[model samples]
Target: MTDAQEPRRARELGIVVGSLPTGPHNALTDVPGVRVGHTTVADPPRLHTGVTAIVPDALGPGRRSLPCGLFVGNGFGKLVGATQLAELGAIETPVLLTATLSAFRAADALVTHVLAGPGHEATRTLNPVVGETNDGLLSDVRARPVTEAHVFAALDGATGGPVAEGCVGAGTGTTALGFKGGIGTASRLVEGWTVGVLVQSNFSGTLTVRGVPIPADDAAPVPEGNSCMIVLATDAPLDARQLGRVARRAVFAMARVGSDFAGGSGDYALAFGVPGGAGDTPPPDDAALDPVFRATMDAVEEALLNSLFTATTTVGHRGTAVAVPHERVLRRLREAGAIPR
Candidate 1:
């Protein structure tokens, strides 16, 4: 189906949440030129996992590349290829997300994928951005199920539209705040510009949605150790440092909704600004960077909200099921006067 048809399908499946209107596809890919794809591994009793790819756009001499930044909230997790991206302030290849134990494999596969692409020149080095969250709860992580093919599949199927959330892609085996949480995304428009956020939800602790705290009431709460990987994309023009600042702002949004960045939680945020063909770099001086900062924070905050609002409850592994009751949540919001009558 065409990208235009994805949102219609999402709405038909009741995959969308919240009252706010979404961008064309209600996803990070909704940003012009952004593309996404996934490889789901559903070998029951063995592996339940996958990989996701986010291709920003073609990179070349005349093409304007996305300006990106990274922020490490607690810094306990591995984010491959960040060092170079942070230092050079550019990313030439697509970004990939996958299961925790598969970071190395994913990175290697990404390198191969980039090399195989057209116009990719001979280079002794390649920076492949790969992020992850633990998914052992529902998958055999040690088995190393995410192969190069999975990574390639994600890259090959990239498209701009409403992306699959919950039990799909990298979120296939993820959990959050003791609930079944996986992939979630949200976006917002500021001054006619769009900003989107996507997350791999596996962090531990109580989760709050729109100020509604969801404590773990089940016999087995998610362990104290877990992590979350967040990606923010926007049409706003921002430099690397500015992007990092924006990524930091996402932490506040997470905290606003009750994530404490516990000892084991690998809370990190990556932000990228969509570049306008030419002469789009921000001014060199610090003072001139204020506008970019504001835009980043706004995008980060809204993107996080989108992540929570887009996710739904899921069931997995040994009959374990957790669901976020949409009606109940909306009713509670109305009763508390959080939403207009």
Candidate 2:
């Protein structure tokens, strides 16, 4: 199942990580009303985990909080609503990525789907925002079969458009650098505003792209609690400290693609802003945030190289992960010319 075959993204393999001009369906739902969903859970003797959902609506409905931010590039993750999303920077619900021991059953199915919505019935104290990484080298991380009806079918099948990368949902049995990573997306359109990115990519190192290291496999192995879970969205009016400085440049665009930040590797990154505080308008002053931090570090390095070019070698259970061989990265992007020989 070579990712069912349409999986060749990363700019169709020419590997163009940034020139800033995307957003039609470059994903992260191209920003407006943003949506995404997934429920993948490969069953077998070990059941690879799953669950993912991100909604982020602007004003018009319930569960509306928005304007969020968090960027612990390496605090090592568990991430269940990072201190009330950094003490009320905002964000109500619908932001669950999963499988670090099922993240409290996906934050108790996102506080029971935002207290079963519809005016929140006089709600009191809410903070569900979950995120995690450890796919346990390939599932069976002590059999935490992510359930809560797979977090209510990834929040009743969250939607908007174009999202589904790699092993799917919480990047089922993730892995990275060594290969078989999962879930990846990208988008950018700056001035008109619409930077988007989504990555789960389990994390390790030596997978570089624009600077070209790409030869992974260094004797294999590479995967532990190794984490990374960036999820960014933008409609622009930013303010949670400019979306935490655009979530610290999306983890400094993941150090261009080859992580060295491995002290177990938590490395988060969450930036949000559908409409942003006190406002009809107000977040863009600081020399206008340097082209929104260079279109969010070029959409977080092409969404972690489209999560290793749409992953597909996953075997999971004890381990397998071997999917970054798109014709050996298209012959090292055509002899380093970066594509098109």
Residues 1-341, model 1: lDDT tens digits: 01111111224433333434557765687777788888889876456679988888755434524578888888787889878888877676788889888988999998887777665665567778899988777777888889999999998898887777766788877766666666766665554566677778777666565566656565644732388888887776556776677788765566755566788777888887776521374434556545444544444444444444444443344434254445555566667666554
Model 2 C-alpha lDDT per residue in residues 1-341, reported as the tens digit of each score? 33444568888866787677989888889888888889998874366779888877663254367777888978878999798888878778778888788898789878977788777777788888888898887788777888888888887898998888888889878888888888888889988888898989888888888787886766666777889889898888878878888898899888898887898888888888775332548776877889988998888889888887887776667767778877777787679887678
lDDT of 2 at 212: 76
TM-score of 2: 0.38
Q: State in Å the error of residue 124, model 2.
A: 5.1
Which candidate leads in TM-score?
Answer: 1
TM-score of each: 0.84, 0.38
Model 1 TM-score relative to the real fold: 0.84
Of candidate 1, the 10-residue stretch with the lowest lDDT total is 1-10
List clash counts for every candidate, in order.
Answer: 1, 0
Native RMSD of candidate 2 (Å): 14.5
